[model samples]
Target: MTFYTYGYLTTHHNTWQYARIGLLIALLVVFIGLFVHYLRNRWNVKYKDLSIITGVLLLLVLGLQINSLVSLQSATKQSGEISATVQQAAKHLKVSPSSLSINSTSVSDNLLIKSSQGYYRLDYNTDGSAFILEKVTLENPKIKLVKE
Candidate 1:
């Protein structure tokens, strides 16, 4: 599914996220096992110390990954709101959202909407405090407005 935010559009990959987290967890478990083995064998103090440090670093990275996942979920919610608003606007212009070509940039809040019926744009202010309809250009024949 395509996710539209203030500045850009993103594609969701549900399976990839889960796979990445699972891989990290597996690596952490393997590291822990190795750490225990080194300590039990008393092979080298340096090896044991290195393993402990590596384990701590992995834990820190795992925490960061979880935090990022939470942030992404919130962003997805905001994207849904933006998408709904766009669909409503398209209905007002008598066109399906699917029929329009949407263009968004990562550096700007403006979204360009274009279709055979006309061209339009909307600007979503920072923090989503406001949504401004920047421009609307209807075709010369002017299609019949359809309310959905």
Candidate 2:
């Protein structure tokens, strides 16, 4: 898996970064609590047992932290894809994304569609006046702009 660092917090929209940081803080608290408890009840448990317990707990927390990071990455990728699709649609329509209303059932012959749940298969005519939206699962969908 490729890993890229999103500087500070903006790259992740402060979502994943906050979660991962929270987990790290939790892990630190757990470790400190265990150490303090051991100090206060020195006669209750053996050193070897305490060591093993601490090791196991640390491993569990580390696993959870890793899972949280992975989930954040997946969410970020999905959002990025949506943003790219919106940009592509704007380019084809020659209008801002805010001005376009897209529906699955809406057929088009001139628009380049980028769908979150569909593959990228774009078709453009030689004259650049018309095109068909072809998806792997969806049948031939076409779009034509209404000229003023």
- For each candidate in turn, the TM-score is 0.59, 0.44
TM accuracy, model 2: 0.44
lDDT of 2 by residue, 1-148 (tens): 1111112111336455676677667766766776777788888676447656766777776787788778767766754544454456557646554443333222234323433444334565776444454655546745442211
lDDT per residue (tens digit) for residues 5-123 in model 1: 32233344356677768768876887888788887889678768777877887887788788879977876776566566666666767776666545532324656565666556777
Cα displacement (Å) at residue 7, model 1 = 16
Q: What is the C-alpha RMSD of each candidate to the true structure, in Å?
A: 7.7, 11.2
Candidate 1's displacement at residue 22, Å, is 4.8
When summed lDDT is taken over every stretch of 10 residues in candidate 2, the lowest stretch is 1-10
Candidate 2: residue 43 lDDT (0-100): 84
The 10 consecutive residues of candidate 1 with the worst lDDT sum are 1-10
Give every collision pair in model 2. 107-142, 108-142, 108-143, 109-131, 109-142, 109-143, 109-144
Off by over 4 Å in 1: 1-10, 14-23, 42-47, 105-110, 123-148
